[model samples]
Target: MEDKRADVQELSDFELYVYETVAEIDKAGGAANIETLRNLIDRPEEDIWAALSHLVSANHVHSTAKGFTLGPHDWAP
Candidate 1:
């Protein structure tokens, strides 16, 4: 069977930070707002939002009226 886990594609340090940020937020049982993620990742607001947007487009994250959360497809082994 094809692995249902998310592939750990080669990623830059910043991209990996984004991935970890999403996972952290999920584990914390809270949503990650752009501002909150920015603070957590120690990145600029624009960069954080951009990363979040990329994650959203890649089906790794979902945006709700409140903020962002892991998407249905974001399963890691």
Candidate 2:
């Protein structure tokens, strides 16, 4: 059997926060732009940008016309 668990990666606290922010955006029936995400996370804009960049690259998050969103990997039921 394939070990699916091994394919999962760990997220740093900030990265997890960034991902969760995007998830909340999904929950609210909308997306979040960088400014809105910044306000929600209360971190330096640069840091948020960094985390978002990484998330996007990893396919854990995605970018939308409105802002950021959870990538397919993080999609929920």
Candidate 3:
């Protein structure tokens, strides 16, 4: 095999799930918290929180006391 998975960056399943959730939320509107995002993404709390941390560090999302919102400059592409 020629390393077919080379294009992947070795993200955890939860991270990928979080990315999808963020994308969905961004498309729909913006911002989601643990409960709301959990409902939207239909995942567990731990996974969602872990992914949120990653997204926040990557500047793809932001966290507030209420919930998380897509970053203002996330559309830089």
1 against 2, candidate with superior lDDT: 2
TM value for model 1: 0.72
- Tens-digit lDDT track of model 3 for 1-69: 321221125557777677667666766766576777777777778877878787777665667765676
Clashing pairs in 1: none
Instruction: Please report how far candidate 2 places residue 72 from its true position, in Å.
Output: 1.0
Q: Score candidate 1 by lDDT.
A: 0.71
Clashing pairs in model 3, backbone N/Cα/C closer than 3 A: none
lDDT of 1 by residue, 1-77 (tens): 43243444744567668877877887788888877886777767887877776677666677888788777653563
Query: Which model, 1 or 2, shows the larger TM-score?
Result: 2
- Regions of candidate 2 where Cα sits further than 4 Å from its true position: 1-8
Reference-based lDDT, residue 2, model 1 = 38
Candidate 2 residue-wise lDDT, 1-77, digit = tens: 52122122566888888888888887788887988887888889999999888888777776888888766653354
Better of 1 and 3 by TM-score: 1
User: How much does candidate 3 score in TM-score?
Assistant: 0.60
Clashes of 3: 0
